[model samples]
Target: LSTVIDGDRRMFAVTDFAGADGSAGLACDTSAAETIRAEHERTVRSHADTLDQLNTAVAIFDTDEKLRFFNQAFQKLWGLDSGFLLSAPSNTLLLDRLRSEGRIAEQPEWRRWKENLLSAYRAVESQEHWWHLPDGKTIRVVANPQPKGGVTWVFENLTEKMDLESRYQTAVRVQGETLDNLAEGVVVFGPDGRLRLSNPAFVALWGLTAEALKPNVHVSAIRDLCDQHAANSPWGGFVAAVTGFDDERRDRRGQIELINGNVLSYAVIHLPNGQVMITFVDVTDTVNVERALKDRNEALEKSDQLKNEFVQHVSYELRSPLTNIIGFTELLSLPATGPLTPKQREYVEYVGSSSSVLLTIVNDILDLATVDAGIMQLDISEMNIDRTIAAAAELVADRLDEHRIKLAIDATEAPASFHGDETRIRQILYNLLSNAANYAPEASTIRLTCRRLADAVEFSVHDDGPGMPPDVLESVFRRFEPRANGGRRRGAGLGLSIVKSFVELHGGTVRIETGQDRGTTVICTFPDKPSGIPDTPAGIRDAAE
Candidate 1:
């Protein structure tokens, strides 16, 4: 049969059939058949339009493995030209083109992979595959076989999603390992008041087993276990913090003393996700050390007070008897007192000198005690530098003469006068000179150099004698640590100590320069006007050269 539709001629085959009554019949229903064929074509077009609108790249291949249809996304995903996609390339040819373009990773068994992918055409169920493209794109491919003997391929870009999953897994693993190795006990509770996370330290600190601290255990159940270990448990607060509906959600920190004598410092932190994290650190040793230090400090203060008082009493007691002895010795040497033989006279002189030295030692002890008590006050005043030097030189003149040591005065650079406590300056110079005399070699010259600097006056006493060794020089200014150290005689070791104390009182510094075989020099620098603030002495140096 032939018909005309839309200006085009269509032809259909007619069939002749016989009926049950032996009659001949002919059938030609071309119009109804054309209508059904047109409807089916429209339905296929509608499905193709829907697939084109999807983000997933879709392609359809026929039983011949030739590409029949593809969406815009498929062209964009592979970066292929539209002309090439419309050329009806076979599935294997398409894969080969993509591989040659380096859009997909190279396959070691290319033929095998291709054969396996093509197997989806005969598969009863959908086949899934993962393709990691060379451009770092991950594509999830699903091949769904159609009832009419073709496959519909879906390509989903899952690179970002898979990357996010991988990073999340790594973060969780790192956090778990970090929490496990921490020294502090840590526990986290969910908003539902159930234990969500905890470390081994938390379990050990609470004296609980791993089973007792298992995930999903209620806070109240953990609280009961904590109460047995601690006199006052902090878990009660933790439970409220985790489950309570307070809007503020303030964090808290406190200390708890356990029945076993351990002290734990704890902090309650509220996370943004409605979880509570509690951390505990043991501070038992730290607390004990603080208490012991406080007690020792108090005892030391009391002992220092007793020592000051005892030193003052003993100094006064010895001073009175020493004054009487010195006075009687002088009286015995007087002409009115019975005339003494030369031996007797020498003995009296010795007694007087010995008493004087003892009195000086007692006075030094008293002065040091006053300094230790922090009550030593300087009498600040202006004094003639030349007169002070003269007086100190006179005081040590006898000793220098006995040692056959000559004093060299060099005050060419010294100021005429400076503001200072006249008595203390005199004492400072006297101590320096006396110390020099004690160590000066027989017939050796001791140099006394004084200079006026821009901001201070400097005084130095250098002795030409066997110098101190490293060991003796280390403690040269320490009180009561007397070492003969090649000196004519060992002193009470107060001369240098007194010098340091008095010079520092004027806000000055003391420095000793000495070494074995080399002579010793003691330098004292006084501020032009007292700074009124004492400082630690400057360092000692080895003056071997």
Candidate 2:
């Protein structure tokens, strides 16, 4: 027998088991049919129990649009009595009863809403609606059209859920307000180094528009923008910190100076959920204050240096002619083949003396100019310290004699030899002695001492002259401030300055020890080996010049 079984425990279709005659009645198995019917009843009861346990309201309609099955939850969802639901009303009649009893919301156009809801019966796919009933409950209804000509409607109550979601959104809005108004820039990046959230302050700090900060932008793109505003960008560090998965995550903090003169302090913190939070704070005012003070000091020093260069170069260019004038004047004053009267002799003497004074001024200016130009190259070689000192003393011997200052050489503590520039060393010694000669009184003992220490050779000229007053000592090494106090002649004031400059050029130092009552001791130190680079600023020939 060939037979078909169905859910209602009834025969659905049959096929004849006869041969060519087609005369055999289907031999149905009564016992197997009873067994299939029992299985169907058990399966339907199990499904009904499962649906009753659900929170969602589920209702099914027959091919004629009459209510066929519904769980207890479905009745509760609509606040309907079980008696009316069991009566099996048509789908439209059920909706009409619910609408009349104020269970469903009254639509703006009732006939139109009813027609729309009824369209689910012929719909080939599912339809959904969020219904706000007149009883103040919200229902999320899903209408799924069946393959066999009917529809299944599932209603979900979402009133409490929506209320909670609304509160959460409100809290998020408040937090967003707080972040937008903060002065500190805040950026949150995901574990992939892609940007997740950034506050307005973060965008404004970098001077970028909000449109540039779209969702899921990689950290490198932001770095590129940040680097556009910074000379030496610190964004590379930020990118590395964001994408790093190292076992140790240390919080990083640093201060960065931008090309636009803004200084920002940044901190990167690793979040617990594999995100990185970076904060930037503008500290430009504090950093600029310190930088401004430092720049001002540097500017003043540069101005002073430039002024020295001006005096030096002009003096150097003028010295050659001035020297010729002094020399020729002295030659003319001498009686080689002719003799002059008393008045002519006086005039010649005056001319010679004035030329000599002018020559002295020109020479001072040239020496200072050479030092100011910073190209004062030294001839580094081993030198006889005593001989160098002797040559320097002889150069200033006449001035010493004119001032009545007796030169006393003290080499008791002196070295045999040292390594330095010979000509420059001689000049340094001569200038110090000349400075002392111009200040020392007549018959005063001017002592020259050379002491050899472990690392350097120290030379000192001690003059038993009236010491410099507070004001003169303050600017003792300033060029072109000529002041002769009881001396035979004033100087161009470049003597001490030259000594200091040349000493420093040899990587040495100069110092003065003097007070009102004490005689002055001007000390100059030269290193034994001359191993250090000169402390003077670098000299480069200008390309344009």
Candidate 3:
């Protein structure tokens, strides 16, 4: 509506007029501008939210090097002031602030480092750098060049992840070292019948080139090399085991006499996931020792039996009182016995443990004496290998748990049944496990491996503990030579000695492989049928030599 005034405030008829583009034109343009502004705001807010959600710090700069945007994490990561950040400083200015705040380490040449880092501005792809800060932080920086004249910088903290990877690598190194120090030659074959891993012992024993031992080398090539060392080599059998030629696919073992007059006892282990492992050890000394002692020792032991019986009878008489002492100690340990002081209880515990150890040594001594007297005979039967191992592991479970140790049993390749004296076998397994548990580090695993061969049963106890030195390894199987070496406790060192005596009595073999940084492994091999080798007590003099 419009009003027209005549000469002097005179009223005319009201009328409405509009141009070609009226209020609608201005309103439409304003509405379109408002919608575009709102969309842009939403996009920026979404991008900002994403940046804020990330654990890494991120920032973007324009082509002119002026800071356009940075997330909250960016400010927090650099410990920068919000007021200074809001001023839209340049990249150089921000770096200057970081340097002044002692956030980054001092560069040998600041100008060159800054220039080299900034060269990513002209690069087409992403560039990365590691920043070691003075505050002990390690930042992995990635500079991604944007299509339109700018860079998006991402700063990630890899401190914890790197630390974990370092520890894992250390464990792996220890494992590799352990393998290298083994007395037995171990070679693992993948499903493809190619060598996957071999230890230094394998290389040295077979005269193989350590530098040339690599993955994916075919078994035939290895067989060809090994055949050169033997008169009638079992290389063909080894090839068959690797290729799964025998339909039965069971593990096998046998003795191979080398052309140089050396005898190596070998076992082929069928591993899970279509893998195979073969181990070899030179058993010439053990065979020679058995042969040398066989007839002479039998006659000597018969003569010594009466004297041994007298010693054992006294030992048996002493066992009863020792048992009573242990039982009474247990009774006194109970709270109902008395309200003892903490120190007193502790002293009692020490006494109890010491007495128990002494009693165990006495019992071991008595048992050996009985064997020496030819009064005990091994009752061989079909033994459940898995059950026996579980039983032994259970016996040591409390001690293992006390030390925060882990146990991993690998009997996947073991036979279901083995022929041996069940009690004695359990005792052997128990002693091995107890020794391993004592030495294994906190949170480390003790692995028990039982492998069955065509004619024998093999047991191996492995521990990821601070290993024995060469001298310790030499003396470990000697009676009364135990040094705790940071284990749970010190013993009379009769554990390995007993293991040796029992193993030899079964007409089998026992060998130890150990080193300082590597770890230790004790392996025992028993034939399927008892050799019926007569037993005689190996004297302390034998251990000394």
Best candidate, lDDT-wise? 1
Model 1: per-residue Cα lDDT over 423-497, one tens digit each: 988888888888878778889999999999999999999998788888888788877777787787888878888
Arrange candidates by TM-score, highest first: which order? 1, 2, 3
The CA lDDT of each predicted structure is: 0.87, 0.82, 0.83
Superposed by TM-score, candidate 3 places the C-alpha of residue 527 at a distance from the truth, in angstroms, of 39
The runs of at least 3 residues in candidate 1 whose Cα sits more than 4 Å from the true structure, single-residue gaps closed, are 1-57, 62-64, 68-84, 95-116, 119-126, 131-138, 145-150, 157-164, 190-194, 218-224, 232-255, 267-276, 289-304, 531-545
TM-score per model over all chains = 0.77, 0.51, 0.45
Per-residue CA lDDT of candidate 3, range 1-545, in tens? 12323543322333445777763221112444555878999999999999999888999988987788899888898999988988989888888889988998999999899988888789999999999888777899999988999888899988788888999999999988988899999999998999888898888777779666778999999998889998899989988889876656798899988877778999999988788999999998988888789977887766666655665688788788888888888888898898888898888788788778778788887766656556667787888999898898899898889888888999988989877888888889989988998888888999989998879989999998888887777678776678788687887677887788788778788988888878889999999888686566354224322
The collision pairs in model 2 are none
Sort every candidate by lDDT, greatest first: 1, 3, 2
Tell me the tens digit of each residue's lDDT in model 2 across 408-504. Answer: 9999888788898888889888878887887787888889999988899999999877787889877777666666765567776667777777787
Colliding residue pairs in candidate 1: none
lDDT of 3: 0.83
